[model samples]
Target: MGKPAKNKEVKPKRNRITFETKAKIIKLKDEGKRNSELAKMFGYSTSTIATIYNAKSKAIVQRAVEECVPQGVCVFKTEYRPTVLNDLDTILYEWFKRNEGRKVALTMTALQCKARSIFAILMDPAHGIF
Candidate 1:
């Protein structure tokens, strides 16, 4: 007996849109052709043709619209703002001047202590915190 017939069948491949088709779509859109007609001419769906038309139609108009507007002119204030460092500069200067020992340096532990002290001073409203 002959072998059982195969159940699977090969499906035809979908066609890719070429550059010529894209150019034709753009040309037709620029010429004000209807999206439905363009779809028929290019063997594409109406929605696909509409998308292409909309994208192409917006390209130049978008660029023109973006170009016509001038960017806003910003004025920056260069005044120096007092900060926590400014508040502590006097106290820190006095501390450094009194502890002028050659071994004095900003080690990690000293940095942490300084940071905590600064935080405390900043939190104290009567200390003229920034």
Candidate 2:
């Protein structure tokens, strides 16, 4: 019998933005600029910028509490699990309540802060960044 061919592994496409860059993107986005404008400003693909807007990754939620979460209030680990987002939401919602302001601005600020850090995590694997 002929030898079977080896299966090829396909890697997911890497995003150009790192978690740190995402933090910047989030900050820019919170300042009330459009995604197209932000993309042009940062030289990132509009679609990628849009992804940051949509908030798909759970890592942002995790990073959101890294600084603000009270000492011994919460702890984060490097493990990836399905329920992490739900827990993160609870933590973040509490954060939201603590920082009261116009709902729109507050939400924007939270999203931007977390997205910036989250973007960095996303890029670390592919771009050799933090």
The TM-scores of all predictions, comma-separated, are 0.32, 0.35
lDDT of 2 by residue, 20-78 (tens): 77878888888898989988998877898888867735448756754566433326454
Q: For each candidate, what is the lDDT? A: 0.64, 0.65
lDDT, candidate 1, at 18: 44
10 residues in a row with least lDDT, candidate 2: 73-82
| lDDT score, candidate 1, position 93 | 66
Model 1: which residue pairs collide? none
> What tens-digit string does per-residue lDDT give for candidate 1 at 24-76?
89888889898888888878889988776667645455445435643221222
Q: Which stretches of candidate 2 lie over 4 Å from their true place?
A: 1-13, 62-130
